[model samples]
Target: MKRVAIFLSVLMLVSASLSYQFYGLPYLQKVDDFTLTDHNGKKVKLSDFRDKIVLVFFGYTFCPDVCPATMLRIKETLENLGDYKKYVKVLFISVDPERDTPEKLKEYVNFYDKDGTIIGLTGTPEEIKKVARSFRAFYEKVPVKDNPEVGYLMDHTAYIYLLDNRGLLKLIYSPRKDNPKRIAEDIIQMIKLLKMEK
Candidate 1:
């Protein structure tokens, strides 16, 4: 019993340490550019979001769990950003553009935040692939027998990438590391550090 208790304590400590690494450190990178159609059918270039912090996620509208959950975390994170909201934008790019029409993406995103703070995007499969490669995001489609529900399911990386004001990569959040409160706190801290730098 004592040995089991000791092991549990050690496991807890390790878990805490990993959590701190994901939310506490500012992991930076230089992401490649992408061009895709926005929810409004406007052609949006990565350069368009320049000079502001951008949180980018790649997922499809039909996603069962991770996508919506991540978006919720993003909304909460923005709420926690306070005045820094003006300096950040959430970009959701769809990998399954074959099914995720521009209008569909728009409605889905608006369902989460109607203020136009989060932008939903879709483009050709090639375009999405380019963006995915740039961000090192993984996505795979598994075909299933004909069903009225989703005929196929996508296994994708459930993550959010935080970019600096200059559109440079700053951090990454996996599903295991994301929560409304944690994401909010992380974004707030990053914005504060960014402000201090500028």
Candidate 2:
């Protein structure tokens, strides 16, 4: 009976420990850096957000559907962050640099920064292409539509990438696979993991 009790205790301990185990996180790979113009027309580097958890998505102001939905979720996630909001940053990179001027980007990105922490970034066409390529995010313009009020649309990869405070690519949330609450939960977990590491 004593031996059986010890084995049961060990099993319970192992099972409890498993609850804290997070298996999918990889040691984040280093990302190439770039300097781009922010919504404020200020030069910003990808490194600027170091020491903070950063969320990134490549989108354009003219986007009809995906961009708005993604931005809304990001806004909701930020709202759900509570006290951790200070340590989080969101970077919206405009894929259509030609039409997405710094001013336009500022308006678009700020609209989603419910807490006023998000940054909108844009640059020359070449610069945009370089940043997009580094992120492995695809974007391209389709032919213009007949409606004069609306212009051509861009088909882009709908990926929300999360980079850790140490500038490591940490997690990715996709619209189909994740909702805002889930995204916020992952971020909270990452923040806790980082705290544990420190």
Candidate 3:
């Protein structure tokens, strides 16, 4: 019996290690509400999305590669979600508040999201800083030396944060590492768990 117990313990450890390697860690902390301007030029609070499984991504529309790729992956994730997509909301928070106006954000997100599920958000520099700090998301502006016309670029964290329907952050995924199918699966799983809890 002791040998069997030891074998089960080893199995559990291996399973957990594999899960973490593939899916990353789950964070179950409650996220505080913050208000930011959406693409529609309206003040929107984070708590407004309490009924949705929110996927928060901090990036600028002018980002040459990472931002667009991540948004496309998020589009693919919503596609994978199928009918459950209605229960999800994607918030694209701009780290570059100077250039990404409400009008520009509306155009940028609409190009990627035809169904209008992805909402682009931008605010004053201080407001952006506060929201970024709350999520532990980092962003910095680097002047473009080679191109004078390009002006500058933003260096920012690329993690996609997942919050449950109750507004508790649950998981963080890397666009370069995690696939859309896996992300969709995790969202569905969280939705199921929330339903079960009720």
State, as a TM-score between 0 and 1, how close model 3 is to the true structure.
Answer: 0.86
lDDT assessment of candidate 1: 0.78
Our tally of clashes for model 3 stands at 0
Rank list by TM-score:
3, 2, 1
Task: Look at candidate 1 and tell me the lDDT of residue 38.
Answer: 97
The 10-residue segment of model 1 with minimum total lDDT is 19-28
Better of 1 and 2 by TM-score: 2
Better by lDDT, candidate 3 or 1: 3
Best by lDDT: 3
lDDT string for model 3 (4-108, tens) is: 644554454355446543263565455779999999999999999888889999999889999988988998999999888988999999999999999999999
lDDT of 1 by residue, 1-198 (tens): 645644554454355446454363345456777789999999998878876778889889998888878888888887777776777788998989889998999889998888888999999888888889988889988886787477998889888888866566767777787776677666665565556334
The C-alpha local distance difference test score for the whole of candidate 3 amounts to 0.85
Q: How many residue pairs clash in each candidate?
A: 1, 0, 0
Put down candidate 2 lDDT per residue, 45-115, tens digits, no spaces.
98988778888899999898999998998898888888877888899999889899989988888777744
